[model samples]
Every structure is written in structure tokens, then in C-alpha cells.
Target: MAQIVGIGLLVLLLAFFTVFTYYAPHGDKAMGALAAAAIATFLVEALQSFVIGDIFSLGFFQEAGTEAGLLSGVIVAFLVALTMGVNPLNAAIIAVSCGGIGLIPGFFAAYLISFVVKYMERKIPNGLDFIVVVIVIVPITRLIGLLLTPLVDASLLNIGNIIVVATEASPILMGLLLGGIITVVGTSPLSSMALTALLGLTGIPMAVGSLAAFGSAFINSTLFHKLKIGNMKSVLSVAVEPLSKADVVSANPIPIYVTNFVGGGLSGIVIAYSGLVNDAPGTATPTAGLLVLFGYNPAAQVIIYAVIVAVISGVVGYIGSHFFRNYPVRNTDFD
Candidate 1:
């Protein structure tokens, strides 16, 4: 129940951002489109973890049925982003991409465009980065997809087999793993790719981890500004980019270790207290941790408890990093 509701809230927030970016009339159309598209692509990527196994994944369909991936709608949206770069078009493309990989034709299409864009831009008076989507980005995506095809296929079959079994004893433990530790670890320098795996194993904790990871950093930076802790105060005031130089330290295992030790600990305690349960089999990392908290819809009361813990973790993460982090602040007058 908490998982479902949290996802719902996240989706709504994304929708809001998409709409706001789309409706604005300005030079930022490409950026807006990119934002919308990035989120959408992630959403589509998530289907594999949350919905049908690899057998039903877009990559699976593309590998088995044809060389193609993505729906007609996705292709059209991609084209739209190319031509207009409007928020509406990009947002749609993003939504569809995230909805399913079958709808994304991989990056081969992008690869094709890279050359065309580069040549035309050089040949003509003005150049455009618009082609990077298909060329550099999409081609890489396709290559990775092709490479991962076998693993994807085998894993899906395996997941289908194990899900029922995992439902019994896996979720809570997995949830704790994810909520407590993976959250911090995933955000560190080791690998964000790990986060994708975490999300798949258990959508719930991963989702919390997602918002908590970024926002908690913001909150921490904000708090320092409130106090008189040098220029981190000022830099964090704007989220033009969502991190600080402390990212170097923050990326270390120590920070994540400290974070998950407590974050997921809280999540685990709550899982036990609520008695709500998980019914899914999953991979390792955070989502695997979610296995403990499935099936049972956490009632309104339980949801509140989860929220409290999440909030507490976010605050803790912020404060912990804020004070403990050692990074130099940029001087405003240096430039």
C-alpha cells in the first residue's frame, strides 16, 4: 500500500514538472523536453522491474520479434523532440520511453542522426545538438541493450520462477537492505547502475531512496545556509546542479554505510512494526529489501509511519552529510 501510494505521488510530481516545463514558452524547450524525456525513459525502464519479467520486457520483444524497439508513439515523439523541442513533445516522448523500451527503438536511431546532424551543422551556418539524442546517446543505449540481451532474458525467466518463493521470506529483508543501506551506497561513486537493480528488486524502497537521496542533500545544504557555514550556504540556494564538491566524499562507502545503517534500519523497524508484508521475489540491493513489505496494503496509519521514517532519514542524511562533510566552498568574488 505504501509502495503504491508513494509511486502514485512520484508520478504526480513528475506530471507536474512535465506540465510546468511544457507550458512555459521560452528557449528552454529542449531542456524541458529532456527533463520530460529522461523521467519517461526511466519509467519505461522500470516496467521490467515492476511489471512483466524480461520475457515481457520491451528489450525482450525487440530481441525476439524484430530488430526494433519502441512503439510508434515513441518514434513520433522522438521526431517531435527533434523538430520542435517543445515541452509537450519531449514530455510525451519521455513518458512513452519510460513506459516501455519497445517504444524506444534503442539508440540506433540516435546513432543514425548523429552523423546527419554533425554534417549538416558543419556544412551549414548554424549547428544543432538535437542529433545527440539519436546518435551518441541512442547508439550507446542500443549497444548496451544488445550486450545485455542474454542476461535480460535469462534473468526475467529466473525472476518469474523465484518471485513466488521470494514473496514468502524475501521482501522484508530486501526492503531493509535497500531502504537502509543500498540507498546510500547506490548514490555513491561505485555505481548508479546499481540503483537500477535496486529499484527493480523493490520499487518501494528504491522510490524512497530516489527522492530521499537527492532531496536530503538539498535539505542538508539548505540547513547549513541557515546557519553560517561558509559558502555551501549560498551555492545550495540554487539547484542549477544538484550536488556539491563534497560529492567526492559523499561518494565514498563511508557515507552510504552511515546512511543505510540507520535509514534502512528505520525502514526495517517500521516493516516489523506495521506487520505489512511483501509478496515478491527480487534481485539484490534495495528493491530486494522491499520483498519484506509487499502484498499487504499498509493502511492509512501505516503509511503515516512510513512517511515519518522516510522524513526522519532524509533529515538525518542531510544533517549528517552537512556537518560531517569536508569540502571547500567557492568564493563569490574569485571570478
Candidate 2:
């Protein structure tokens, strides 16, 4: 009964979050900030602490990366507020208030508080607004973050537990589902990085997500070129970062999505078979995800799996392009 209720609540919360992202003002930007924060913090840690520090035995890089990871909530809140057009100083204050919380909770606090801060900016008059924000708004925002922290953490933890159990039960199947869906999200406005962070994905699930995303870069580039959906620059950009060519992908969803799903699923199977683990959440990005894999697994093993996934993804893209060769596509510009 409790499990059913938990599932129901998770669905409801996800639905609300989805609607908020679509309908709320600057919602997409706020979520984009989440991805940016993850890159700035977690990705840095993956590269610095894991790769540089652990591999090279350097204390400085390790300490710096660890510190950066600790500031995840601060960075997230700050960026979210700034993306919502809050004053820089005020954003810093909101970020500080959200200190000691996790990423998702910090985002919620900052996102909700940004509106109040905006309202006060209008009502409190120009010079006085900063004072009011520091005095009244800061503490309130912090309080909200503190209150939401446990709830958000608990919810994400539950979801993570479910994923862990599923992975244990059947890793290959979970890999297929997560890899495909997350790669699709990687190509969408909703960002795979943000989704993985929200779910607090770790272990094999994170491995699947990370590698699947890396493999998608090849898949997208190959598919775009073969299908003649965009120019050379756009195709290259999609390979580096699919979101850069989101309009093109969105415009030609049938071919792009199908190819990504197929390629990412194959890559997921490869990852699952290898049993590679990625402990870092939100590293479900291409370059960073690949680098982070080195942090967790044997370098040679990681390389072999990555190469296999990339090659398979490229082939999938090639085949998909041929299959959709005659299908009507909207060739888009880089601009």
C-alpha cells in the first residue's frame, strides 16, 4: 500500500513539475540553470577530484573539486535566480540562504522565491528593494529550502531505491528504458542532466545514463548528416551537444528520436553488460559523462565499452538515416 501511494505521489509530483516547466514564466530557463549548475559543480568534481586528484594523487584538485561539489545547492539557487532575472546581489543572497540543501530543494526554493522577490522589487520601490530583500526575503527563502530539503530528498531517495531494485532485478531491461528515455530527454528541452539530478541516479543506472548520452552525440551527428537534416555546422554542433540543435531535432523528431532511442538502448546494453558504475549524479552529459566514467571504472575497461557504444551508435544512426531517407524532413539552419 505504501509503495503504491509512493508511486502515485511520484507521478503527481512529476506531472506538476512538467506542467510548471511548460507554463511557468522562465521555467525552462530555471531548469536550464539546473543543468548548468550540475555541470559547474558535479562535473568539475568528476574531472578534478576523481580524474586528476585520485589518478594523479594531487591534493589541490581533489580539495577544489570536493569544495565545488559541496556548494551544489548554492550554485543551483544562484543560477536559477539569475536566470529568472533576479538582481545579482539578491541572487547571491538567495543562494546563500539555500546553503546546506541539495540541488532539487535549492532549485525549488529559489524558483518559488524569485517571484516574491520580483513582487517586492515592484512594490518596494527601487532603492529600498534591496534592503527589504536582504532583511525579509533572505531568511524566508532559506527557511523554505530547509523545509523542502527533507521532502525532496526523501522523494528522490525513494525513486532512486526503486531504480536500484529494478536494476538488481534486471539490469539490462532497466538500462534499455533509462538509456533510451534519458537520451531522448538529452535531445529535448528538459535536459538529461537535470532529469538525472532530480532523480539522484547513481551506480549502474548512472552508468547507463552517462554512456547513453555520450553515445547519442555520435548517433545524432551521423543521423543528421545522413538524413541531410542540417548544414555541416549544425551537424557538428549536434554531435558536440544535441541541445544546441534542439530546433532541428524537434523539427524532425521522427527520425532523430527513433535513432537516438535505438542507439542509446544498444549503448545501455553495453554498459549494463560491463557493470560499470558512475556514482556521480547529474553527470549524464556527453563529455563530462565520459570523463566521469574514468573516475569510477578501470580506464581500459571504460575505454573499450565507450568505443563499442560509440561505434554501435554510429551504425544505428547510419541505418536510421537510410530508413528515413525518403521521409520528409525539415532541414534547419544553425542560426
Candidate 3:
């Protein structure tokens, strides 16, 4: 019962984020901004600090990457605010206030403060609005971020721990669950990148997530092409990055998501046995995820496993398409 509750709470939190992305003002863009920030901060740091710097003993990359990782919250806060329509100056101010906070906390604080800033702009006269924002918004945003950081971090970390424990107990079961859900999320607006980052997942769990998404690129691409859902460009787009064709995928969720789940699960099983570890938190992206895999494991091992994952995903996509071939699908045009 306790385990059930914990799992349920994690699902509920993810659902809330999904709903919020669709309903909240500029939520989708905010999330896109968040993804970009994750790439800029986490991905860069992961590649540079771990792969290049540590491997080559390059101090410059190591220090530079560490600096980027440390500023993740500030970058997330600034970009999210800017994407949500906050002016550049005010966004920077809010971001600076979020310095040293965690990414999720900064995101929430900046997002909520954007509304306040906008309201002040509309209600308060221009001459005084800037003054009010300078005086009122920055500190409040910082305080909120500071207060939320520990709570948010703790909650997400607890969820990660649960997953880790489950994985240790039963690798295949956890692999299937994480692989399928994270891949489905990679196709959805919720974004696997954001999810993994927020969870701060590492080790086998992170490897599962990264490979799952990597395999999903092939799964989605093949599925999209075989289903005749869209033209070549759209097919290629999803192959490179599922989020690029998110609308089409959303429109045809049944086939796309179901196939991704199967493919991702298969890939996850491969990862579970391969023993590849990804210490990077947010490299669950497709291309980046695959590249980062080499950082933690040997080239030959990573290559062999990645090929296995790709073949499994590709086969799953081909087979899944035939199964769902007769199923009704909405055709979409990329142009």
C-alpha cells in the first residue's frame, strides 16, 4: 500500500505537469524553453565534464562544464520567463535572483512570477510598473525558489530512489516500465529530457531512459512512415527527434505511443543486461543520449548494445505497424 501510494503520487505529479503544459498560458513554449535550457546546461555539462574533460584530463572543459551545470536554475528561470512573454530585463533579474537554486524550483518560481509581472505591467502605469517589478518581483521570486527548492528536490529524489530500488529488485520489470513510459514521454509534450533532469536520475536507470529514447527515434520514424500518417519530411523529423512532429504524434497517439512502448521496452531490456551506466541526469534525448552512452562505457560494448537496441526497436516498429495498419489514423501534412 505504501509503495502503491508513492507510485501513484509520481504518476499524479506527471499528469499535473502534462495538463499544466496544455492549459497554462504559453505552457508549451515554456516547456520548450525548459528543454532548451536542459540541453544548454545539463547536456553540455554532461558531455564536456564527464566525457571530454574527465576522459582527456582537460581542465578547461571540466571547469566550463561545471559552471554551466551550476547555473542551470538561472538559465531555466530566465529562458522560461522570456518564453512566457516577460521582458528581457525583468527575466534576467528574476533569473539572477534564482542563482544557486535547483532547476525545477527556478522554473516554478519564474513561471508564477511571470503572471505577476504581466499583471503589474497591465495595471500599473508604465513609468511606475518597472519600479514596482524591480522592487517587488525579484525578491519574491527568489524567496519562492529558495523555499521550493528543497521540497521539490526531495520529492523528485524520492521518486528516483523508488525507481532505483525497484530496478535493483527486478531489472527487467523496471526496465520495461521506465523504458516504455520515458519513451512515450519523449514523444509527448511532457518531454523525457525534462522528466529525467527533474528526477536527477543516474546509473542504470539513466542508461535505461537514454537508450529507450534513442531507440524510440527509430521506432517513431519507422512507425510514422509505415502508417502513412504524413509525408517524408514529417517522417524524417520524428526520426531525428520525436518532439519535432509532436502534433502529428499527438493526433495519432494510439499507434505511435503503443509502438514506442513496445520498442522502448525491448531496448530497455537490452540496457538492463548491458550494464551501461549514464551518470548524466538529462541526456535522455535521442542523439545526445546515444552520444553520451559512450562516455560511461567502452566503445565496443556501447556500439554493440546500441545496435541491438536499434534493431529491436526497428523490428518492433515494423511489426507494430502491421498490427495497427488497419487501425484508423488521422493523416497530417507537414507543409
Q: Using TM-score, give the best candidate's number.
A: 3
After superposition, which runs of candidate 3 have C-alpha atoms over 4 Å from their true positions? Answer: 1-7, 125-128, 184-203, 223-258, 279-282, 318-335
Candidate 1 lDDT over 126-218, as tens digits, reads 323334333444444445435544543443334223322433556655444434433333332212222334234434443333323333343
For residues 1-335, write the lDDT of model 2, one tens digit per residue: 34345445554654555455556787656756765676677667766776577667899998997788778889989999998888888888889987777777888899999999988777777878888888998889888888987887676566455456557668776777667766876775445665686687888899999999999999898887887777888788778766666545655677887788788887887788787999877777787779878878899999999999999998998999899999897653333
- Give candidate 1's error at residue 244 in angstroms: 15
Name the TM-score of candidate 2.
Answer: 0.74
Candidate 3 per-residue C-alpha lDDT over 1-335 given as tens digits, one digit per residue, 9 for 90 to 100: 43355456555655566566556777666766665666677667766775678667899998987788788789989998898887787788888888898777888899999988877777887677767777888799989998997887666565566566667678987887788877887886546776687787899989999988889988988888898878888788777777666546655777887788888987887798788999877777788788878878898988998889899999999999999999887653332
The C-alpha TM-scores of every prediction are 0.40, 0.74, 0.80
Candidate 3: residue 4 lDDT (0-100) = 58
- Clashing residue pairs in all predictions, respectively, total 37, 0, 0
Per-candidate Cα lDDT values, in order, are 0.37, 0.77, 0.78
How far does residue 277 in candidate 2 sit from its true spot (Å)?
A: 5.1
After TM-score superposition, the amount by which residue 121's alpha carbon in candidate 2 deviates from its true location, in angstroms, is: 1.8
